[model samples]
Target: MTGAKSDHVAAYIGLGSNLDGPRAHVTRALHELAALPLTYLAEHSSLYASAPVGPQDQPDFINAVACVFTRLSPLALLDQLQALEQRHRRVRQRHWGPRTLDLDLLLYANLEWQTPRLTLPHPAMRERAFVLIPLAEFAPQVTIAGKTSATLAKHHDGADLHRLLP
Candidate 1:
């Protein structure tokens, strides 16, 4: 499905926040993602709570994934996502550290691409339950690295991940 029509392509973005009212941050980011130019917020997973992936002293994170239909090129999409992060005052104090907002371009119409700036199928998606489980909720049948989203999600432990009330 990498050869979708030129007008639009379906892409997935992973959203997460751990600083400054994370749930509100994620909710606002969802609205902003929908408002992006040439993009439609197709669907999203419920908010999920998970322990921090890096430093232990930080607060838990709120996470979710979104699927969108977009006419923008992959790099352009990346630029928009980065701009969104910056708008939320995202910081890079340390790798996997807490943030106000984090957006990851997980997939783009099944295309496999690599640049100094981005990677398709997200290099760490398969191994992260936070990404796979939420991704499977909207796109269970999608395949990545030879396994479907449902399959990957089903196999992950996700012991630290829990869905939040709507």
Candidate 2:
């Protein structure tokens, strides 16, 4: 006999924070992310310290990527992530400025999509070592935008990553 179908779909979420207790923000965000409807936090990599990428002169960011299993649609998942950000009082006053928390949907079960409000495979995940490293650690064989995490990290060279042990 076949088992009952699970209402679970795998996804990747990128977590980052650089202000108001960066480490605490990341930890809290993970808990909040798991609390979303039809979702479970499957795994997470240890945080990493990454140099700011845009608009130099910002605090170094604490970053990690989470693996989640969820039945929520991509848009719905995005909505929940935004709500978690708001709960932490995340602000968007400056581009890449410090914030309490930030959550980004990095990939959604190999589904390729782009909309005015969101994009899967994150559009820029391949070039960022911070994202690629944690992702490679958790799901090395997973493909994103037609490339494996290993390939993405190989192309990246991991120049500005410093692992943050928790």
Candidate 3:
């Protein structure tokens, strides 16, 4: 399913930034993602300012989720995400460390698979309040692992997350 089209699968991307111009980086990341081939930006959640999830010493992160229509397979989409990270100079030097940008494939339509490089429904999405809150905004009816968006939101760790802008 490398280059095949699957009726323009609906995909969700989790975006975040904590290093250098966090808000601007997130905003630019959205535009860059919208510019990718075979991918259409469908909707976006309100940007939120959230406390750092891991290694809490870093700066707070600006987070949001985006819905997109893409003909690219999951792996291909992952490739694009990594490329975007590189463009933002994101370094995985430390786990959950501060970065210029972070783009995660939170969900990929009705598809699910786990590979060394990628995982569907994003392995820890449910545990991350930063992802859950924004995702619920744009995909309140979507379900994953038999869990509704509302349920996921309820299960979040009650982190500090608030919309910075609409």
Candidate 4:
């Protein structure tokens, strides 16, 4: 999907990786996101190390959040994210299983909608410290469901999240 001509919107994307040189996968994905046509990366959170949310047998994840300004509609942006993931050899064999890269659309200008292909505000973001902690770094004041990222992050006090880089 595409947006109105030249109408840029701010979007946040959640990134995580636990396989295939995880840190390099994330770093390279950031560059790919910034290079997407009609989009510019606005900000990015520091890299983080977090316990895997599912299937604990896998490696821990390196995660972060990135903010971008883009003319693409939510779905189009999602397509771009998936393409980048494919470029990094992401495979969808198991739910929340380890992967070379995972890119998620966390928010798009506060617009909330759902389709078979995507969901706004990421349905599970609020409950996951992996998403919230890094998101708070770049968007401390941004609210989801009336709660700031920082405030929401505090709710996940037991989540195993640690900053890995500035």
Candidate 5:
């Protein structure tokens, strides 16, 4: 981050994978996130195992959440994230297909944004147990739209999730 420390924005990133040794991909990604330029990883949640949200044929996914303080604009951070995904050999053969890594910008400093390429407070994050369970670990009070993470997470049955590591 550059300029005043006030310039830094707290961003939440969700991580998941089901291919190429899922646990290792997620574990390595946690370290890689800390390496983002002008960015610092404030905290990260433990790994979790969950059923895939889309196709049922693929293996289960390993999921986690992270909070980062960064100077990069939302899109810039997104670009960096996509690049990291590519480094992991992510292939987009189909929607929600199995991949080596998946990184999502779940929230960006409580800002709501939209563009052809991306959206702040990711569209589906509110409903994903994989995303919420881990997010609650570091940011239970975080509010998106009119709901807080803790409140939103409260209603989920959590039967779809299994904590894997701390």
Candidate 6:
């Protein structure tokens, strides 16, 4: 989603995959994100292996976070993420079900706004170690409501998060 905006803001995106070669799906999604028009993949956290948050019968997921600089607004960025998911053959057959690729807009320039389509700072991010651990790796200092990711991660120590890649 290319636009006329010249200013770029920092945004954090959460990526996860549990189907069709999980690792390969995540890696390919990262490349696609970096190739987005007017967007730059500034940083990425190490991949982690985690149990599915829902539907325990599904395969485990490989997860990571990407910090990107982009000129696209929140909605446009969300559109691009959904488009990327569609390209990867994502299906909405079940809630939190296994997927080929899942892209979530975790945070957008620290902006706190929400619409029917998306939410800022990801409502469940703090409680999910799969998101916090990797996020704390590169963005330990990022805060939501004055709480740092490092602190949030510490709070979720009981979560089933295992580092799978450097």
Name the top lDDT candidate: 1
Off by over 4 Å in 5: 1-4
Question: Ten residues in a row with the worst lDDT in model 2?
Answer: 1-10
Report the lDDT of model 5 for residue 102.
Answer: 98
The RMSD of every model to the true structure, in order and in angstroms, is 2.3, 2.8, 3.5, 3.4, 2.4, 3.5
| TM-score for candidate 6 | 0.93
Q: Residue-wise lDDT of candidate 4 within 1-115, one digit each (tens)?
A: 2332357888999999999789999988888899998898888889988899878999999998998899988999998899889989889999989999999999999899999
Better of 5 and 6 by lDDT: 5
In order, how many clashes per candidate? 0, 0, 0, 0, 1, 0
Tens digits of per-residue lDDT for model 1, 1-166: 3434568889999999999999999999999999999998888999999998879989999999998889999999999999999999999999988899999999998899999999897999888899999989878988898889999999888899999999
Off by over 4 Å in 4: 1-6
lDDT of 6 by residue, 58-103 (tens): 9999999998889989999999999999999999889999999999
What is candidate 5's lDDT per residue for 1-166, written digit by digit as tens? Answer: 1232687899999999999999999999989998999998888888999999888999999999999999999999999999999999999999988999999999999799999999988999889989988898778988978888988888787898999845
TM-score of 4: 0.93
Candidate lDDT scores, in order, read 0.92, 0.85, 0.88, 0.88, 0.90, 0.89
Per-model TM against the reference: 0.95, 0.93, 0.92, 0.93, 0.95, 0.93
Between prediction 2 and prediction 3, the one with superior TM-score is 2
lDDT per residue for candidate 3 within 32-147, as digits (tens), equals: 88898899888888899999987988999999999888989999999999999999999887988999999999889878899999999899998888888888887788788998
How many pairs in model 1 have backbone atoms within 3 A of each other, for residues 3 or more apart or on separate chains, i.e. clashes?
0
**Residue pairs with backbone overlap in model 1:** none
| Candidate 3 displacement at residue 154 in angstroms | 2.4
- Which candidate number has the best TM-score? 5
Better-scoring candidate (lDDT), 1 or 2: 1
